[model samples]
Target chain A: MNSQLAAYATSNLWLIIIGMGIITFLIRLSMIVLLGNVKISDTVMRGLRYVPPAVLSAIIFPEMLQPAPHGVLDISLGNARLVAGLVAIATALISKNMFITIGIGIVTMWIWPFIIG
Target chain B: MEHSQSSPRREFWAGVKSEIPIAIGVFPFGLIFGSLGVLGGTPPLIVFAMSSIVFAGSAQFIGVAMINAVAPIFSIWTTTFFVNVRHVLYSATMGPKSQHLSLGWRVLLSYLLTDEAFVVTAWHYDNDNPEDLTHKHWFWLGAGLTLWVQWQISTAVGVVFGTQLPESWGLDFTLALTFIGMVFVTLKGKPMWGATLSAGAVAVAANGLPNKLGLMLAALTGIVVGMLLEGQGAQDE
Candidate 1:
């Protein structure tokens, strides 16, 4: 990775940023702009309802279980992120407050290492 | 109820006000992304440009990390595409509501469409009567602009000063926590729960897949499961 980073070129980075910006914008614009007037099927509409929870959970699970990106999954208490994520989940469920959940989650993540050590 | 009475200016400000708290939650992420980008060897100029250009938080983080790791450009683009495709869903949901707007309005609002902005704006759309949606797009514009400004400012701060902050502060975890809050709040009814859990499990199991294919697969699985369950529930009633 270090060697690759060393070999990385500024030109390549520019290419990436431009390419990513275009693709992301198009994705965001796909339905709202391109298909603005098209009639969506009921089935697709039903499926869209779940998109938020499903996509979000898909994101949340990996961040919590793996903690380290592309690393092995760790469900143990040793994984501070996992434990803290659980705390955040519980706080969200009970308090139904975004501020409280994030506050407690970050605090837990910060303090977990000392607690276990 | 008073949809027609409210001017576009009023709705726009209302949108901005509603998003302030959520924007506060999102502020840390912009900072983390900026600092991480620079620390990962990306130039400060490019890192800052990314906030304005790419705009999506998760995709930008992943893209910067991949660039730092010297991942192939194709893989980086592919990963970013999938990670952000969820915006397509958001756009689809918001499309009908904004269909009446001019092309320029649609274009601008689509650019501003984001998870945080979408959630708040969608909630507003859903709660109000469908007949009363004339100035709601202004609200979306206000909300989106607020987040957009906050993101740029935070990213600037992080790029300029974030490296001085300790990495051990684990500030990146705030993004995860924010998502957790979002997921739980949107989670109502059996189908939503089933979809969320299923998506989460699949994503974990499929984590080893190349180029983050697992995320897309897991999301699709969850959506299908949720739709099936909803269909079944309807039949049972």
Candidate 2:
């Protein structure tokens, strides 16, 4: 293990990692101490509320539908994620529940894959 | 009350319960992170360490993603930076609740910081009296710790046995579902929609960018687009 790590290491990898960690610690620490407890302006808070959904959806949607190096749509029907996502949204709107939204969407996405595959 | 017998334990479980909703959905992502970490040759200990010490889902993922044959210092820093910008928002929301806390407690909260806990704890504050904001720190610790522990255990499983698991068969969508739950709960108002749509468009359009620097561009664009739409929404209202 020692030999393998030495083979992988170059000059001062530790310095780089440590420096990066310090910077990360500072960014997070500053945010937590300074911004964590303050009341944010309404516009900022409203904008913040949207970040997770947007980021998550952007990550998920493209991963699901895109057809790889061939550049084709993955499904004409039975794209479990698309179907389940819509279902999840509908469930969320109707029931306003978290467990159901995830449970239904996951079960649906998991099954649709096997069914289609 | 039975709670009196084991107050700390009870408190700990209460913390877990508050986080359980997010956890059930989170376990799969944890498994994916673990498997990827193991496959990427991150020692089981380091994987565990990152999850415990860093304790940020996206950052851990980004770290493993960049554990290449020769990752430059700046590259690792850049990736972690983009991955955790969301924490800035998490911190802003947590601000008022910690004003009465000592600097030590503030530092601990920063270590235990997570977006879900921030949302849940902050919601509790926004709806309840700020004076009653005691013990939420405990809950945040419990939730983040459970996740940290689970991430390591799952990663160990993946590392020790990544070879055994068959084709992934697009199981990643379970993660997508978890995100759907979060997005649905929070996706209201015109600015949010505008920001979200623009970011999504950017993410897809910029898919060609190396190492997905597009994620950062998309997020920055999202912040601006959201603020702009908010300006518009305010006018209409």
Candidate 3:
């Protein structure tokens, strides 16, 4: 691990952070600043409508399916994260409340290890 | 027309109030990121700087992990861009409503934009009363600033004390739970379902892809699928 850190020198880390900051800011700023005046096409508008669900789903799925970062895919009932995710989904569907969904999900995750054992 | 006009100050406070619950959820993740970064061999100062500089939760997390893995700078930037490109869609959605605002306001608001802030601000805009239009941006500012402060403070706490916290507590799971909540709330109609299901499936299948290219590809696939389903629905109508 120290070897890995050694390769990532201090100057390089700073450069990466600044580069990430600029890139992220520009992505956030893209349409708001550049396309404020342009009339968006119907197709593009329709695509935009799906962005939230798609992007978020993309982020959520791997986290649930994988036991750890870069861990093997685990879709079985033994997978605690998968179980907690399903609980969260059911809670969201039923209650339509964010706090409740997250609360119940976290509770399920904490207790799940004991349940299976 | 008979109701009293709401002041920007009032709207701003309302925005801040509305964001409190979401901010509460996000706070733990900030702590997790801070602790994780420092524990993973990154300098504490750089970890704190990431919170201020990137101001994006997922991208920052991925960035720290990449730094620990000693990923190339170009790949880090590329992954960060892909992780955050969704914000472009948020900006576009808000563009029509905010077009009338001045350039400075646009720039500042854009900088403040994040997934949580976008959710609150968009909800406020969606249900906005005609009279409230003038001060809505203030509401956006308030919501953004609230999360901003919460994130910074949480990161500081994590950097200073996170290593002592037990990993068994599983504080990191909150991040996944938060995203799940966000996903379900935004899901509506058949097209939205199509988008979500496809994205989830593709993301899992492509999880092995390097530099999180899988996420970008999955998102695009879901968007296209959603649009196609919507178009087909329109034709049937």
Quick one: best TM-score, which candidate?
A: 1
* Evaluation by TM-score, superior candidate among 2 and 3: 3
List residue ranges in candidate 2 displaced over 4 A. A1-23, A35-46, A65-80, A113-117, B1-15, B128-136, B186-195, B207-213, B220-237
DockQ of each: 0.66, 0.41, 0.65
Query: lDDT-based ranking, best first?
Result: 1, 3, 2
Give the alpha-carbon lDDT of every model. 0.86, 0.63, 0.85
Worst 10 residues of 3 chain B by lDDT: B123-132
Query: Model 1 chain B: which ten-residue window has the lowest total lDDT?
Result: B125-134
The C-alpha stretches of model 3 lying farther than 4 A from their native spots are A1-13, B1-7, B69-72, B127-133, B235-237
| Model 1 stretches astray by more than 4 angstroms | A1-15, B1-6, B69-75
Error of 3 at B150 (Å): 1.4
Using Cα atoms with residue i matched to residue i, what is each candidate's TM-score against the true structure? 0.90, 0.75, 0.88
Model 1 lDDT tens row, B1-237: 565578889889989988886788778889989999999888899999999988899899998898888898999899888778878778888887787899898888888988888877877787666568778898999999999999999999999997787877878778778889888855688888899999999999998887668988998999999998898899999
Candidate by candidate, in order, the iRMS in Å equals 2.1, 3.6, 2.2
lDDT string, candidate 3, A1-117, tens digits: 444335577888889899998998888888888776688787886687777778888878888898674468988878888999999998988888889989898899989989999
Q: Which candidate number would show the highest lDDT if scored against the true structure?
A: 1
Looking at model 2 chain A, which ten-residue stretch has the lowest summed lDDT? Answer: A5-14
